[model samples]
Target: METAPVPAFSELISGTQRSAVHLEMRDVYDPGSRRFASWRSGHRENPANRDEWWNPFHSVIAEAVARGVQVRRARVVSEPVSDYVQFEYDVTFSNIAAGEQVRWLPRRRASDLALPGNDFWVFDGRLVRLSHFGGNGEFVQDEMTENPAVVKLCVEAFERVWERAVDHHDYRPA
Candidate 1:
């Protein structure tokens, strides 16, 4: 399948009728983001303060969920997680607050799974957008694929991780 430029997540997620599942396999993502700076400075926002923490991304998620889309995300992280992963952990409350089902799995537990090479969101079990990133954790590109083989692999990988992962509320950043 030919790849397309990154489409708006709201559009992609909204087009789904049943589910949109994301699998994040990186320990670090965009290590240079300003959000991480705030976290490092001991300035993590309180999740309960919706006025302070809610953003467009959250709005998109909320809308999708309101329309009955099942939005789920699973992360495979290292034990004694990297600072970047911890930063992700800190901000994850917004994801949950926005109606996402988030979970975390230590990498050691994923050794037997056949995961894809990149992070991806599989929407409705029919399409996938593979998120590519650099070694420094910066965004590179997003490739959208409707290939049945690839979609099957992604759904299988996400379900495998989801089955093994701890719910975000119960997961303490290792």
Candidate 2:
């Protein structure tokens, strides 16, 4: 993992050959974004309309999936979900359409498991791209690492959460 010139999310995922697993532990990330505002204002993106729902993020994921790279995302949220989490739930069809498997785990169910301090994506079980967020749920820069100890910790943590989480389609935020 190279941190000097931090690579984009697409670069990280493209470099992966086998699998990419992401563990998102935040209930509200970037809470003041326009996307969330639009959703709150009763503006929903129609999945059928690619022009309306497609974006760079989805494009990269779809490309990776076409190349046989398995992508999975697991989120840990509070029991009574935050507004942002509900918003995320409503927009997850795009992720599904892009070929990413998503799951959600309640914080209560994760009490016994050891988790990382920040969110991250472990690529091919070797490199880890850690997500950093401000105290106010604002977007922060990401850091990448290839330390064996750190990678192992993230991989294990992600697997633990993924195992306990419910599939996105079945998860009913509450």
Candidate 3:
């Protein structure tokens, strides 16, 4: 059976590229239940939406590790404020199937990228990639997507921050 086509953005360069994409987003509080609920209700604010957005990406990483897809991640463990705790991950794909892992990420301003802020969005098209603004309006979102070169630079930045980051066990399952 045929599947639906992936959406593209002006900032995002759509093509079959053997490249690494860097992504940053606000982590949903109750991703498991909330994520799935949002998907069912069409309510981005709902808890299930968080899970819907993350599980697939998590799976992608897991799969890459399993199948040897050449992927890795770097993240910022903490920020000055709770809301500022920015976590970034870089997934490099050695295998580009179906044009660069069809994906999407919602954008937020650098200042507004904080805790209880909820201004981040990310998704691998094959997985879940949507999020809601968790009621904080401190940050105004300026979003865009580019090609491999720009993405590589972002990945480098994520690596720098990741080096100083603390391991986050908050979201890890028991």
Q: For each candidate, how many residue pairs have backbone atoms clashing (under 3 Å)?
A: 0, 0, 19
For candidate 3, the 10 contiguous residues with the lowest summed lDDT are: 86-95
Clashing pairs for model 2 are none
Per-residue alpha-carbon lDDT of model 2 for 55-169, expressed as tens digits? 8999999999999999999999997998889999989999999999999999999999999999999999988889899998997888989889899999999999999999998
| Candidates ranked, most accurate by TM-score first | 1, 2, 3
Positional deviation of 19 in candidate 3, in angstroms? 7.9
TM-score of every candidate: 0.96, 0.96, 0.33
Q: Which tens-of-lDDT digit does each residue in 1-174 have in candidate 3? A: 122233442212222122233344443333334434444454433323434344444544444445433333333232232322221111122122212232222222233332222222222322211123434423333343334443344544444433443333322211
Worst 10 residues of 2 by lDDT: 1-10
- Model 1 CA deviation exceeding 4 Å by range: none
Give the true-structure RMSD of model 1.
Answer: 1.1
Q: Model 2 Cα RMSD, Å?
A: 1.6
Check candidate 1 and list the clashing pairs.
none
Model 1: lDDT equals: 0.91
lDDT, candidate 3, equals 0.32
